[model samples]
Target: MPRALAARWYSDHDQYQNERRVIWGSEWLMFGVTAELSRPGHYVADEIAGYPLLVVVDPQGELRGFHNVCPHRAGVIQWPGCGQTGNLVCRYHGWAFSWDGSLKSARDFGDSPTPDDHSLRPIRVETWGPLVFVNLDENAPALASTLGSLDTAVRQHAFTDFAYGRRLVRTLECNWKTYVDNYLEGYHVPLLHPLLNSAVDMKTYSVEVPDDTYCIHRAGQVEGSASAGVWVFRYPNLAINVYSDGMNVERIVPLSSTRTAVVYDYFAQDVSEEKIQSMVEMSNITLDEDQTIAELVQRNLDAGVYEAGPLSPRHENALAWFQGRIRQSTGAR
Candidate 1:
């Protein structure tokens, strides 16, 4: 019989810190979509696992990732969110960095020998289909190895050709793991997401753990449904949900031990304003239902009353696999 993770795993501060190093620090995390940085000078800046990252399209038309902090005073060089810029200039001291992360200039430091060493620290970055992923661990396996057959599985849908649609960011009052655990299984769908259950045939839902790095959730189609949809959850915190109308890539970022920020970037083949609005409304409704239960689960886990529970073998195998991965990654026996 599969078992639920200990309550402490969800609420402990030290454990959360360990997770930052063991899991988030080493995993290949999805940063954004390639379309976001389609042109030279386009950039996206954000924080993941407390580390600020900057991804940009260089003048040479290559995607690059950096630490986003100025090497001089460690001040943030780029502002948060996406924008277009010819060069990244540190507002604190006017230290300038080229698109490729080379130190272009240092204000008032005339040809200083140390300027050469002040270039932005590079982070490992790779693209899979339309998604952009970054890794802090320079030695980590290639993104393709981590993704396994996920690309082939969704290739027929031409996911890579999809255009950027919209994005929604929501801050949830729950541990990041709580949100991830809730996402890995369909056990709670009939009870937690009635609308979603009605849209997809839940009776035929199945989970496949292709490898330790990710899981694919396949559900049968309902009559006249646009598409069966493909859902992939990369270990730790990235979710790729693909529907006929569009795809939603969700990144679950930890704000604190008990708070998480969920960022969803929507992409689609045909991005009309009407389609974007409709997708937003439908996604909001589904996300509202999920947030409610995830927050409730976090509250109960903190109450000190529920230590653990047995997993439903038929419905929660994926959840068990996810918790096991956490244990394996964090060495939390």
Candidate 2:
């Protein structure tokens, strides 16, 4: 990787603003919110970047999001990942918050009878494809506009009909970009993926950047090879891997300069327990292969041994295209 690109990974301002513009300022971020949240007060705790969040579907069937913190003393509102609660009550001061993050009640503390100034901060939220997304930027564009052509692709491909099947979160020793770059191309599949090679036809693989913010890779069988299904990317850092019977949506979340968290979600059309488990296993094998290469690349970048490498037009236009988009998005030359 060129130091200019790698510098984006290591620079404090670049990293901070990247998270601000891409993650917090962008459209829907994948979190959980299926029929599982049908109950009145059921809620789930989620984290983005370093901000913790609380999402709930209240009695009126309306979805709401909060900062997951009590404004009174800056205490955590929900400690557990999720459960039913009559109302959101701060454990520290007994202040209560409504489903919409409005202050509902408060215990005696001082002459301030009203808690109007104390409601939990609200976040913009939207639901699509059975997954909930939050936007920390209150005035950001609607999820529909931010997604652009991706909305058509997901719908036309019938991707939303699949149900949630499995999830995996793993920590890796690499900058998040390393993982994104590794995934942008199938050039290494012949050497890195053996079991996958048995299923995926490497020669027939090709990538399409439908728009500046979106890309998809065809993972079907090569003319003389065999693969499973098509893999897709929706810009910045979301991977949509479509399998024969299901799909996996993986997102890259950076935790630090050399650390990242990979959130993998698997979904299947049919809801059989056995089928779900098998899907998870197959996805894991593919991920392990990618992780091995990503870590090596990250190490080399850290050692300052590589600056920029040439793009192989034959096998890597997809990867190069992604780099170009990053340059445009971040204003890099």
Off by over 4 Å in 2: 1-4, 7-18, 21-27, 33-35, 222-227, 328-333
Q: What TM-score does model 2 achieve against the real structure?
A: 0.87
**Best TM-score goes to which candidate?**
1
For 96-152, candidate 2 gives per-residue lDDT tens digits of: 777767788777866665667788998887876766677777887787787777777
- The reply for model 1, stretches above 4 Å from the true place, is 98-104, 109-113
lDDT of 1 at 176: 94
The whole-model C-alpha lDDT of candidate 1 against the native structure comes to 0.85
